[model samples]
Target: MTMAEKATDQAQRNTEIVLTAMRELFAEKDITALDRYWAEPYVQHSPQMASGLDTLRAVVPDLEGFSWEPKRIAAQGDLVFTHSIVHGWAPNPVVIVDIFRLDDGRIVEHWDVIQDLISAEATVDGNPMV
Candidate 1:
């Protein structure tokens, strides 16, 4: 495979790792597994909260059940984009878009936009328009 193809493959694998860890974290209502996927200075851009990994670790427990299904992924260079649906206590189905920047085969930064998937107008192309 070409270098770009290899990078894409690696990025896809990394995305899977992060997604699985996130799902496991929510299913167990714990952040232990999530720590392995997020960087120390991780940044989150969500409507509800914006913080680093440490803060997320502290707040995850307060959330009841959390699980997500990643639907699409695309990557180029060091960035990967993912569209998914998150299901949990606060909302039944929340559309979320996550962007991750990877460094040396590990995720170093993250940004996400989440919206409640309630009405038909709230969704577009099977994802939240954010």
Candidate 2:
């Protein structure tokens, strides 16, 4: 494959890794299991989560029923971003955009924005966020 093709393929793989880890972390709530997916000294930029895997491990719920339905994942180099909908953890379904930075196939830094899911009818553009 050409160099450009190789880069695209690698980016796709990175997107897959981020999506899988997110599913396991939020949907499965397997906090400790993240050791396989995250690098040491993971930095968190979300207002809610603090830095490090230890802090993340302490806050994640070890339960089922939660779900993260990702609409899209974009990746370039070591950065990956996913747009998704979350349910069962908040009072209402929420829309989230998560950004992750990876190193050697392990996620090292993270950021996210969470917003209340809006109704399709309420949109002026008449298009769904997803």
Top-TM-score structure, candidate number = 2
lDDT digits (tens) for residues 1-130 of candidate 2: 9989988988888888888888788777877668879988889999876888888777677434678898888898889998999886577888999899988889999999998888888889877877
Candidate 1 local distance difference test against the native: 0.70
Where does candidate 1 stray beyond 4 Å? 89-92, 119-130
Per residue, candidate 1 scores C-alpha lDDT tens digits across 1-130 of 9988887788777767666656666666667775566665666666566667766777778776667677887877778888887777354677778888776655677788776766656455565343
Error of 2 at 125 (Å): 3.2
> In candidate 2, where is summed lDDT lowest over 10 consecutive residues?
56-65
lDDT of each: 0.70, 0.84
lDDT of 2 at 20: 82
Worst lDDT window (10 residues) for model 1? 121-130
TM-score of the candidate numbered 2? Answer: 0.88
